[model samples]
Target: MASRRIPKAAGCSPIRAVLAGPAENVITEKLILKPAPETKTEVVQKNTSVHNDNWFELMAINHLSEKLQAATGVKSMKSGYESLVEATAMVSKIYNPKRQQELVIQCLDSAIPKIILNMIKTLLPQTQFTREYFAAFTTVFFTWLIGPSEVRESEFNGRREKNVVHVKKCRFLEQSNCVGMCINLCKMPSQAFIKDTLGMPVNMVPNFEDMSCEMIFGQEPPASNDDPALKQPCYKSCRAIQKHTAKCSS
Candidate 1:
């Protein structure tokens, strides 16, 4: 004899889904409010045996609602199975060991497709700041990192604009697309840092001859600025790099 079922009205939580994340989602937490070394009541000396263990601080970044945070950087896909075809094609191009090796030495703008790099940024922040075996997680986590502006705008056929949903949590102004805008530019840890450490252990790195693809997401029309002189240069850079970097998707 078994019970029928649990009612939908009682207790159900999305926490597990949020925490047991996927390639497309990243979970971040706030840490700005913590006391600095001077303000703290406890002091642990680096080489002293008498120092106390530090407490684990597991704070959470407020979850960006999926719609509010769908990826803005990927190109719109063709209908039906072609979307799968297009995506698979992109993966085949990117996953080459050659590209990965090139990526180790190259900037996000010069090495990889902007969408691929952007998707990586979207998921890793939620990876709990743990270890550096990120390429393993990139396959699964990259897809779940959603962007709100992306989804709403998707419905409008490039005509309908969605009102922003603004929520402030920690230092992240949660609703602004600016967060996504800054994803690669702001969140990137330099390849130099990565290579320096990885070289100590796994020293082998690959080489890419010539890998070129336009960035579909970040490449947009140059944003208008007040100073005419400054405006022209920015417009030129944005336009010139259209051969590779996505102009606008963040």
Candidate 2:
């Protein structure tokens, strides 16, 4: 009787056949891999919320907070927006209105090195480009204090330009909830800071009704007496008003 011949698979090796043993046995002895158990560390990471969106945002907040504390000589127990508000309130208490504005400009001066300021002033010409550049820069670098913002078109020197930063809702104003704080601690100081340190003038017009603010770059800020923001009344819910002993010059 002729011996029956066994056919090899298209790419099967004799070694594989030896390792797998008989085809029937190989089919029955299937190997299943169970995923490794999740570690406690992985579980914790999965449940954790990401507080800082990016490294730049976190660094900016920390540096500004440190500068604010240094300017006011008051350490904040909290961080970020709360810390800024605490330092601002302390600054208001520590200095006169004029001095409060001065300290904030000084804080910004220290926060940004004079050399960097010089470079910005010397390199960026005072033109529409510079205004638009700083407007875009503000939206990117100052989102922590101002919240989400966008650059919009506005008339600068009778020409339409995209040099306005419309802050949807100012975090500083909303959190402080004080018109005086908004003007002394933020609007005036910020305009001065930008003008002196960045060599670009800006006018921050805040709408007390909705807490929104529009920063018009290249426009000089109006005088305190002429400013509508200064004339606005303090909120009844203001923390300063809540203190009863404190008077808010909103």
Candidate 3:
């Protein structure tokens, strides 16, 4: 004897809805499913690679390279890494510790709201005057431009805050390999840009041990005398320190 197979009900997906009753008694269940919206974290995680070929990044590098070259009388023979090193060396040569801070802040002020930042401003209309928004923005932007970073949320003054960005490894710092450059170029200028230009107070703390850094937004920086970054000795691998070992030693 041949066995008869049961027919599935109309408009019912066998995989989505299992039938336990006769075809006539089976409830026609329609499963309407959609892909979930991507969160900011998900979006950032997806874009892990640095967008080196992007026009915004290219323009920013050029603009900053030109400005640094002009300020320090150092020219960039090569793009990217070489330009960064040459510019940093020039900055070291042209200014004392005090003046280095000033020049870096000035250069950043003039250079920031750069193409990428401007695009961010235009894209994220709601990224104003909020620590959380800026933090999220930084996570995506920095991860795109620099490298991967972790965004952490915490409470401040009895309110939930998302203002801390932890850089597992700073590509620029690692490449430049100079404590002075980290302070004068990356740390100071970045803080100044976020605080002055973006109107959000921030303090950048670099950990020389692991080459990690923390960008704390919505926090005021301490005075020079009290700031740890100001007192950090030059990196052992610092080209400036090697070039002027006698002066640095004294």
TM-score of every candidate relative to the true structure: 0.16, 0.75, 0.66
What is candidate 1's lDDT per residue for 1-250, written digit by digit as tens?
2334434555773332223446567668787787555411112111112212122211111111111112212232443222322332232233342332333234323334667655555554422121223432322332222111111111123443321111112111111112222222212222232323322111111011111111111112132233121222122223212433333322
Give the per-residue lDDT of model 3 (tens digit) for 113-232.
Answer: 477666654564433246777777777765533456888866667776777888876767666557777777677767776665556778888877666788877778887779887787
- Give the per-residue lDDT of model 2 (tens digit) for 67-152: 97887788989876567787788777666778888888888888888888899999997899999998899898778768889999
Q: Scored by CA lDDT, what does every candidate get?
A: 0.25, 0.78, 0.66
Better of 1 and 3 by lDDT: 3
CA RMSD, predictions in order: 28.9, 13.8, 15.5
How many clashes (backbone N, Cα, C below 3 Å) per candidate?
33, 0, 0
Q: What is the lDDT of residue 172 in candidate 2?
A: 77
Best candidate according to lDDT = 2
- Pairs that collide in candidate 3 are none
